[model samples]
Each structure stands twice: as C-alpha cells, then as structure tokens.
Target: MSHVGKSKILFVDDEEVICSMAAEFLEMQGFIVDTYEDSREAFDAFCRDPDDFDIVITDQVMPKMTGIELLKNIIGIRSAIPRILCTGFSEELNHKDEKEVGIDAFFMKPYRFDDLIGQIKKLV
Candidate 1:
C-alpha cells in the first residue's frame, strides 16, 4: 500500500550518502521526508514541530546524540510518534531494552528500501 501524501517522516543519519539516498527513495514513494545529517539539528527541528511528522527514523551512532538518545528526547516531547532505529552496530543494541526505551522498529544498516518501507507501513 502506498502511503502517498499520508505520512511525513523525520529521518536522521550522520552519513551524508545514506541520508540523501533514503530521502530520495522515500520521496519517490510519495512520502514527505525531512533528512538531517546532524542528530542535534534533527532533534531541534523535531522540537520545533513535534506533531509534523508521523514517524522518526534515525541512525544509532551519531556524533553528539545517539539514535537512542534522540528517541528518548523525542518521546519525552511526543510519546505517540512511532520511532525507528537504524544501525550498523547490531551487537550494540539490546532489542528488548530498546523497545522499552520507545523504539517501535529497527533497521540494520545496508537494509533494503523495501524492508524499510514495509516496516514503516506496519507502524502507520
């Protein structure tokens, strides 16, 4: 099912290529996406418009704030928004613990766009 015009996503990653690629792909799929390479900046943007996005997708290993840290701050502001954490360091994550901390989904790095879309569809 196409979420065309139905959802807006806030996506953050420290990697420029990943951010650009994901944003491009998501936009093509008809979902409005705001991409950021800086976690702090992304958090600030989200804070300014907490209700603007339907979902949050973030990379785990960022410079200033980790994905988990960002998600924590996000949920503190608006607990209802669904959060997805993407990371290359799977071993660093404790799935059960992350769920407790407010992550609704996880995407390992180098993931297929189809899988990401499927997870997004599931969440909203």
Candidate 2:
C-alpha cells in the first residue's frame, strides 16, 4: 500500500522491539517510517534532513535524552514539523506538560493503531 507521496514519520523509542513493531505497522498503512532506538541518534538524523520528515512520534524516558528534550531540540531548529509524544509513563507527562513541551499531540501507551492513524492524518 505504499504511495509515492505518503507522509514520512520518525518514530523514536529506546526499546528496539517497540520501535520496529510500530514502524512495521505504520508502514503497512502507507506511511514512510524511520525508527530510531536512541533519542540522541534520532536527533542527529532529524538535523541532517529535517525536511525529509512530516511528523515525529517518540517515547519518553530514553537513556541519553528524553523524548521531550528531543522534541524541544527539533522545535528549536524546525518548529513547524508536527510532533507526538507517546509513552507508557503517563505520570511523567500530562496535557499541560505536553502543551508546554510544544508537542502537537500526546498518546498513551497501547494506543490503538487506528486512533494513531487518525491523529497522523489530522496533523499532516
């Protein structure tokens, strides 16, 4: 179902399995997904070609850097790209914090793929 003009996504998570799985799922839905298991590395990739991606979906509580920190850095360079924070640790971030962090959307862990798709479509 891949399309030439599908929205490109950068999905970051310290957990390799989670990132890979989500990437596969999103890809099947026709999105171009690039998965990163390290937030720091993801930042570097984003910096190298910020315009290559349309949106970013990342997990919180990473090793070298947190997702919020990554989003902040990305915004500093390119503020218009949509960002989504997806984490199992809901207590670590709330609606107010998400807004303060400049994320366009927030999704809790175990979110439905369809719901995520809807948000992605809405954002991009």
Candidate 3:
C-alpha cells in the first residue's frame, strides 16, 4: 500500500537479507526507510536524531541487543514516536508483554507486506 506522506522509517534486523528486502519494499511503497543490520547501531542512530524518523520497525532477536531492548531505549528517549516490533515465533513475547512495553504493533516473521504497510500507515 502506498502511504499518504513520505514517512521516514527506521528498520532494524540482524539478518541482512530481511532488512534489505523490507527496506526496498517499504521504499517502493512510497516510504523512506533506513535499515540497519545491528541493533546497537540502529539505536545509536535513533538517539542521535530521533526526530529524523516517523516510525521504527525492529526485529526481536539480535546479537548486541534485542528488539525490545532497543525499543525500550527509544522509549526513554522519545516515547511518542511509534514503535513496531517484529519477531519470529518466540516464547519470550506474548501480546500482554508487548502491550506492557508500549509498542504500537507487533508482527511475526514472514508477515504479509501489505499488512505491515497498512499498520504503518495507521500509526504514522
């Protein structure tokens, strides 16, 4: 789905393929996406300029920091910016936990691109 405005998104995933593909897909759908393969780096970038991004989409599992951790840090810095957490099936996260963390949305791996885009449009 094409978004109304050029929403800038920060997408973080340890897997380069997923990160690259998602970034390209979002860009194609009329969003400006910045992708990172390292969660810490992504967090650093976010802290550097939180206002540069309209939304954040991050994968749950990573080497340096988990997606939730990154989101937590982001929350401390800029809670108002919408955050979306995406993960493969994990016992660690339930809907309750996500809600407690205050993320705007949660998506599982292999998510439908259209569905994710739709959620993003609503949030942004």
Candidate 4:
C-alpha cells in the first residue's frame, strides 16, 4: 500500500540493525522514514522541529535515555504530535505506561511489520 500524503516518520533506536530493518520496511511501504541510532538527536529533532515528521516510533531500551523520557521531552515541546512507544514489554504493561504519555500507539518489539504499518496508517 502507498500513502497519499507526505507522512514523514522518524524511527529511533540505539540498535542499528533493528532501526535499519524497520526503516527499510517503512520506506518500502511508502512513508518517508528516517532512522536515528541516538535518542538524544532524535529528541532534538522532534522537540526543536516537530514539523519535520508526522509520527515518531522509538524503542524503549536505549543507552543514555529511555524512550519514555524522550517522548516526555518531545511532548513538552509539541504536545499535539503523535508518538508510538515500541518496547519488548507486553500490551498489559504498555497500557500502564500509556496513561501518562498519551501515545498514539504502543508497539511491542519484534512486532509484525504489517501490523506496524497498519498502526501508522491509522495515525496518518
């Protein structure tokens, strides 16, 4: 499937392999995807210039900062931007975290590529 508008997406993960794979998949699905290995840079991009992306998908377990922290800071700057927190945790645990951040979605790591695409589609 292809997108109708320019739905820019940012994928943040400390792991290059995971980000690379996901980035490629998202691009193939017709979204403008950018991958970042550093959470700090991703945070800066989202906070400083949220107009650059339509949605953000970030991994939870990172080196310097957690995804929740990054999302928190970004939400402070741009409260309207949509966000997705991707983690290895179950949906039950994610639900507890959801109350605070108000994310557009919570995606588990190793998630199905098609399912991820579906989530993005719903948001965009």
Candidate 5:
C-alpha cells in the first residue's frame, strides 16, 4: 500500500534532534513529513494550508505551547484532522482521556517507529 492519502504528516517538538529523527523515520515510511522546533512556526506553516496534512504528531513539552495547546489550536481550524500526541507529560496531562480531549491517538515518548507507522496508518 502506497501511503498516498496518508502521506502528509507534521511533527512538532521543541527538540531539534527529536524532530529530525521523527521526520527521517516517518519520511522513510513514505510519509511527507515536515518538522518544526516551535509551535508558532508550525502553526504558521499549517495556516498556509491546513488541508495539506493527513495526520499530525506533536510532542507535549514545548516552550511556548505544549502538545495539548497545539492540538487545541489545530482542532479549532481543522476538527476532523487525525492527530497523534506524543509526550513525556502523559502522567500529568489531564487530557489523557481521549474522549474528553478528542484526540485520535497518543504515543508516549521513546515509542518505536514501527508502532507509530502502524498506528498512523490505522488512523488515516
């Protein structure tokens, strides 16, 4: 299966290395991924064309905006866009309940690339 409709994935994280790693792995899986070190910049890219992405994966602990904050912003614009929230703050996040937060999926940090690929595939 060619990841046609499932290609465009956005990865947002404060850490440059994590962003690069995710981008590299996801891209290798035939996904069109763009990574950003800041939510503001990522938001700007998304604002240019929100519909370009099929799925979004963001880290939880960022400088200005956390993953939950990012998710809220994205949902405001594109409600139905599937999202995967990856975080180390899972233990402290009140929105861990997917039903309450309306998240499509959640992946804890240090997650395996293959697992992420599979989950994203299922979501899309």
Candidate 6:
C-alpha cells in the first residue's frame, strides 16, 4: 500500500539497519521519513521543528533515552502528533499503559512494512 501525500515521519531506532530499511520502505510508500539512531538527537530535531512531523515511530530500546522517554518529550511539545512505539521486548509494553502514555499505536519488532503502513494510514 502507498500513501498519496508526503506525510513527514520521525522514525527513531538504535539499530542503523532498522532505520535505513524503514526509511527506504516508508519513502517508497510516498512518505517523507527522517530517521535517527540516537533518541536524544531525534528529540532535539523534533524540538527544532515540532510541526514538521505528522507521525513519530520509535523503538523502545535506545542508548541515551528510551523510546518512551523520547515520546513523552514529543508529546509535551506536540500532544496531537501521532506516536507509535515499536519494540522487540514484550516486557516494555507490559510495564506501561500505552494510552495513558499518549501512544497511538504499538508495533512489535520484526513487523511487516505493510502492517506499519496500515497503522500510519489509520493514524494519519
């Protein structure tokens, strides 16, 4: 599935491979994707221009800050922006109430790009 407009996305993952692959896939689907391996840098970029992104997809595990921390910062800046938390660890989801934390969607790692696209479509 492909999106029509170029909806800008902030995608954060500690893994370089994941960031590169996701960026390529999302760009192919007609979305403008900005990827970051460092959560702090991603948060800084978001702060620089909060309105620049329509969606934020981040991995739970990261170096400086966890995805939850990054999402919380983003939410404080732009509460309405759609946020998706992706993680390989089930324990991460178990520890927090996603709705309460302002997450729009939760995706497991090793997910299909089509599924991710579907979520983006629904949220956007």
What's the TM-score of every candidate structure? 0.91, 0.90, 0.91, 0.86, 0.89, 0.92
| Best of the two (1, 2) by lDDT | 1
Q: What tens-digit string does per-residue lDDT give for candidate 1 at 16-60? A: 999899988888877889999999999999999898889999999
Q: Write one digit per residue (lDDT tens) for candidate 2, span 1-124.
A: 1234398999999998888888888989889999999899999999999888899999988899989899989998888898999888877875565686788788888888789888998888
**Candidates 1 and 3, the one with greater lDDT:** 1
Global lDDT of model 1 = 0.88
Report how far residue 60 has shifted in candidate 3, in Å: 0.6
What CA root-mean-square deviation does each model show from the true structure?
2.4, 2.7, 2.6, 3.0, 2.4, 2.6
- The digit string of per-residue lDDT tens for model 4 on 14-47 reads 9889888988888888888888999998887776
Worst 10 residues of 4 by lDDT: 89-98
Error of 4 at 67 (Å): 0.6
Off by over 4 Å in 6: 1-4, 94-97
Tens-digit lDDT track of model 6 for 1-124: 1245579999999999999999999989889999999999999999999988899999988888988888888888888898999999978664555665687888887899999999998888
Question: Would you list the C-alpha lDDT of every candidate in the order shown?
Answer: 0.88, 0.86, 0.87, 0.80, 0.82, 0.88
Q: Candidate 1 has which clashing residue pairs, if any?
A: none
lDDT of 3 by residue, 38-113 (tens): 9999999998888898999999878988888888888888888888999896776766657756988888888988
Candidate 2 residue-wise lDDT at 4: 44
Indicate the residue-level lDDT of 70 in model 2.
92
lDDT for model 3: 0.87
Candidate 2 clashing pairs, residues 3+ apart or interchain:
none
Ranking by lDDT: 6, 1, 3, 2, 5, 4
